[model samples]
Target: MIKHYCGIFGIYNHVEAARMAYFGLYALQHRGQESAGIVTWDGQKLREHRGMGLVPDVFNERHLGKELKGNIAVGHIRYSTTGASLIRNAQPFLVRFKGMEIAIAHNGNLTNTVELRDELERKGSIFQTSIDSEVFVHLIAHNMNGKTVEEAVMAACKRVKGAYSLIILANDKLIAMRDPHGMRPLALGRLAGSPVLASETCAFDLMEAEFIRPLDPGEMLVIEGNSVKSYSLLDEGKKPPTRQCIFELVYFARPDSIVFGEDVYQCRKEMGRQLAIESAPDVDFIMPFPDSGIYCAVGFAQQSGLPYEHAMIRNHYVGRTFIQPSQDMRDFGVQVKINPVKSMIRGKRICIVDDSIVRGTTIRTRVKKLRELGAKEVHFRVSCPPIKHPCFYGIDFSSKGELIAANHSISEIERFIGLDSLHYLSIDGLLRSVSHPEKYCLACFNGDYPIPCAGGGCSRACLEVTD
Candidate 1:
């Protein structure tokens, strides 16, 4: 599975701001699971609740109603892309500087973190956590002298490069900003006449908020006293080209979301349709590996005029911290996560549809189980092209060494995964499935990173693919 770094949600001018932010983060739980936090700004002070676990595990009725009383709130769910998983790295990182209390929740990775961290440390700027998100707080603080939070934010943004969809709670105002490349998703909404912000529109549905629109690349909006004002991060007479993360549509986003001004379900369904057009393997029935692959499998089944079956049953009750079986059990985790329906799989030629293959090991184990179940043939269809590159701007395949396709050919992957055939939606097919395809960051598939990262790129193994 490709793990996204984080998800953020914020609300301003609401009586139950923290509660609403909790629900917003709950809806965005799929984006991260390592940690969860919420910060609330009362008229006179800031309150916080952060813990290392799922939203429900971290927060309760008591935390929301009693501890986090405020009219403004910012929430974060983190999966740790730039820092180790620790309580200290949990966010809606709250800090007090110069009589102003500020809290920030971030939703993307920064490429120049090392340089900025070095510079800050040299200037005696102490860091409390190793997460790159802290750099924003320090930068904003450094610029806070003789400047409004807006000016500080703009100045801080100007110095940093890469993906960020940030929500800041500074005193009584809630601020939202997106990177110039728009490498992450952030949506604007209205709830009960209060302005709200989230990493995806799906949160709006949960909060009963009206989906206003997506925040544009380089756009910053300041929400104060039920009013919103927009500002551009771009220099005058310059509009940066949009290079939104395509992986959000492919896997990171919920199917119910509207990201980058497009419907995620429709895009995934179209990708499945396109995959069928390009590589429709002859099969008796189509199946998905459960939740992740269900929508795409539906599209494949519809396009191929084949039967759609729930051949694999997912154990929804499986907890994130399930007790590990002894090493002797081997594929115990995978087996418990999902089990093939014996009746549906025996003597069948099945086509399994999925979003994308990351490491290929888990799928290989699942396919091996299918063989044990007496399957005639197993064909795999991927809705997106092989992820051949690392992503520095958020979705966590940070090392080319971790990507199977980055080191091996299509046939090699097919053999390794024990499939009769493995086909991926071509790059053109993926583009055809979405609107304004030119605006997407296809860096994971093409290695054309919009903002270069010093510590990220193709590894020697990726370079060896063509050689």
Candidate 2:
């Protein structure tokens, strides 16, 4: 699978606004963990605090609630794309531009970010984060023409390109926008009669908020002073970008969240069922890689009529930076990440379910561990199709030759991972699983990018020109 960026979220127009936005972002913490941030507007100004940590660890009932009180607010939990990881890169990017400071939190990658940044820098724009989102502020600073922040936002949108789902906070307004092509996910909601905005409808469900339509793929929705309006920014020069990033269904989003009115959990479950129907394994119990595969495992279990086992129990306490020091350290991290429920796995024929295989280092290691732990048989099942190319949009991976499954056939992969058998969901079956299938861009799996690649795939000229 191509490495994907983190999720983004925000809430607006509620009493105890900042605290409420915190909870909304808290529900979305699974989307991104590199950093978290929140900015609240208390009539006169915006109060902001963001740092690296999980939601609860970064925000608290005492300080987070008291210090961030406002009638309007926006928040973010960021994972970097097109920038190095560091404190300065953590988002909810705030900048003073054209006489007003606006904060922006972004979810998708900007294919043309390098070009935008260069143009802005040549004009004397100084940037704080290595993050691509900083370019939006610079572009806005240079182009804002309206007396109000909303007008400035509209002006800025005209100059920017590529995939973006943004939550932009102005002094008196919260403007949520999606690229005209709708390459990423963004939604609007309402709770207690106040309008709200979030990256997913699932957050709205968590708040018992009524779900509204997603921001039109290229439409901008402005929430200001308790009123809302919409604007179409489509340029005749460009067709809407069609790549919606199929990774969202396979790995990026929390299964509980909904993207573009489609339930993420349901999409994965359906993928598992379709996999079972097509691959029909000669195994006993089905197992899943902890966390991501839980729902798919359930679908596999129900479809195959085999019991699901917690063969590997994951440790919840291990931090992201917990790199093991040796094979023993690696094994120990595996033990911490998941330990075999010995009784459930011992001497049984088993099927393992996972979202996708990237490097295969983790899989090769894990499959061997299962054998050491006494699994009689191990058959592997992947929910998504093989990843043959690297993602160029905003995710970190770009070397096509490095993907384990890209060069290896199923039997070759089975031998490489040391699995008794292996299978992957067909690309067609994978597409059939998502709601509004026609709307998504499955380019990574299918190599069918909806828009022109600025010039062409992997060309330095294209990369430099578009980015």
Candidate 3:
């Protein structure tokens, strides 16, 4: 199972900005399920509603109508790449400093969080949340000495590293920025005449907004009243190479969304087609792991000329099992979330197509269950290459010890997962499936981190302790 990073949304100069943000968060619910939050600015003051759960569970008509009213707002859904999972860490993190009220919603992790946090703490700055996003607020506040909010934001951006796609709301303006590497996605849109921004185009679709374009790496925009202005954080002729996270196409973003200016569904389908060409296993029919795997399975079936069917049914109501805090709970949730169709697979040789395999436990359980349901033979095909390195730029697979591929060979993994055969798409195949492969960060598959991680390790301590 794979974990999702956070999603962020913001709107400026809309009558129902808070309500619109609520819907935007609903559309991005797939990106994060642990918590949801929305903060609004009403010209003079800020109002917000934050809670731990899915979007619908967190906000309702009463909360949206009574508590949040503004023309500018920002929303966030979190999955905890940094800090513990708690209410205090829930975002659209609101803070009051020097008589200015500001709210920030972030969608990626920072590599310099500990260093910045320590520096601020030593100067007597009190932190309200454990998440690295709070460091942005502190950094901006410290740099606000007779400077415009945009200037302060630029200063803060210069001080931080790693992946960050941010939506910052101040009393007068709404600011949006992406990291220099572009390791996360952030797009601009228009709702009626108001400016809108979100982590994916799917959010714009849900709100009936027209997508303008994706924010460039190291680009920052300031929106106020009905006007939008753009700025560059990087000095002229010093722009770093853009390295958008490749995994966003592989699994994170919704299939219906357009991320980094590419169609996610078509990309996944192409990956499936490539996988079929690379590893064509002889099987009776192709079966997907449900939802995320469905499109790839279709592409594989089309390419391999094999029958496709839904052999395993997924529970739409069940939240992602990977988000469960403990391994035991995650193992239990996986069983409850999917059930095999006994009659269809009673005596069939099935090929299972999934996005990627992380720990190997979930897939192992799935293969074992299929056999118990009387499957004659089970073959596994993964759309992406094995994840051999931990991701430090927002993905939750941050510990190398948790990745089975990091420790075992492909044949060993196949035997451990109880599969007749197992094959994964090569890195070259995955790159060919996308429009601009050179712009993607493939550190999870090949240890080529576009942005260097703190302490050169994959742990919470490593993120907090700088060399």
Candidate 4:
């Protein structure tokens, strides 16, 4: 039940830009469920429609076909990490500066939000939303200084720190950029000869767009009327190492997605294979927690020569339980979303495979349910290493205190979850499972943050800057 950060989509010079963006946002709906939005430009004026709900609930045929008429557009699906869950913070944030209108959709948290906001506020710049994403718009607007919009965007990027994948819609151009560390994913694609961008390739798949490639760290592309101009913000030989969030493959992204140029499903399967090789427990059968755990469990079962079964069924309609904001709500959501099959669980030594354990509440509750359903023994297996540090980038894992592994020993966690035994993929094992392991950020598991938070601590207040 890990909370995803956000998803962004943009298209340039497409006649059905708003409709295509709707489909793209629909494909990326799994990334965020708190709110959805889209802003379009019809060569003369900007049109916008946003709401605090799922994609289908927010946009309809009328809004896409008429109200949001445009040949260029940007869309967003948000699970707030930097702001409170309010409609005002729903992104594709549109603003007017010097008689020019611009819209931006962002997919990461800013580490220097507090510092930047303070500096701006002191200089008579009024703020809009509490979200750190609004900082980007302000920075771009104030830094224009006779420079082109693309140049202003790059200049603004230099003033910020931490993970960000951006899709910006100006009056005449659509722009996309990735952070210097590439901590978040942004992909370039094409649909009917028009340039498009999204947080993941899964969106491209849904729209029948061809993925060109993932944007390099610190790279910006200004797309105008099917022509794209690329620029690199980093100086020669001064580029920082790429540190894409490894959790994207383990949990955040769709299994069918190609994130950071690697297949997510294959990576999870490799993780499961590595888990089997490193921590194979004696069990009658392997059962995945459902959905996220299915592919990993298959790999584990295959590697261990054990049968795999769906002991728990998931309700697809229910949103992710981990992002429910409260322990009581998360616990309740888990119960309503997943139910154990009594016939499959009775009198069995079952290994329950899951992606990762954050607070341990959801897994603990599910384990209790299994035991109540007559499971003789529940051995818990995690495909990823223990999350031992808070994520300041985009993930909702905000405090070290919220991470069970950061506070308790493995055996203690096993006892707390009421499992017969528990095993998590080792850090080294998890690293070996991915391509270009050195290019990944594993701070949540190892406490080696690729980018340090502002004021030198990973506290929620320091990273998020909600004020």
For residues 318-370, write the lDDT of model 3, one tens digit per residue. Answer: 65444555765655676678888888988899999999999998889889888
Model 3 CA RMSD to the hidden true structure, in angstroms: 2.7
- Point to the candidate with the largest lDDT: 1
Per-residue CA lDDT of model 4 for 238-262, tens digit only, reads: 8999999999999989999999999
Instruction: Estimate, for each residue in 114-155, the C-alpha lDDT of model 1 and write its tens digit.
Output: 778889999999988877788899999999999999999999
Give per-residue lDDT, candidate 2, residue 77.
83
User: TM-score: which candidate is best?
Assistant: 1
lDDT of each: 0.89, 0.76, 0.88, 0.88
Q: Which residues of candidate 4, in runs, are more than 4 Å off?
A: 319-332, 463-467
TM-score of predicted model 4? 0.96
**Minimal lDDT window, size 10, model 4:** 319-328
- When summed lDDT is taken over every stretch of 10 residues in candidate 1, the lowest stretch is 458-467
RMSD of each: 3.4, 2.8, 2.7, 2.5
lDDT of 4: 0.88
- Give the per-residue Cα lDDT of candidate 4 at 131: 84
Instruction: Using lDDT as the measure, name the better of candidate 1 and candidate 3.
Output: 1
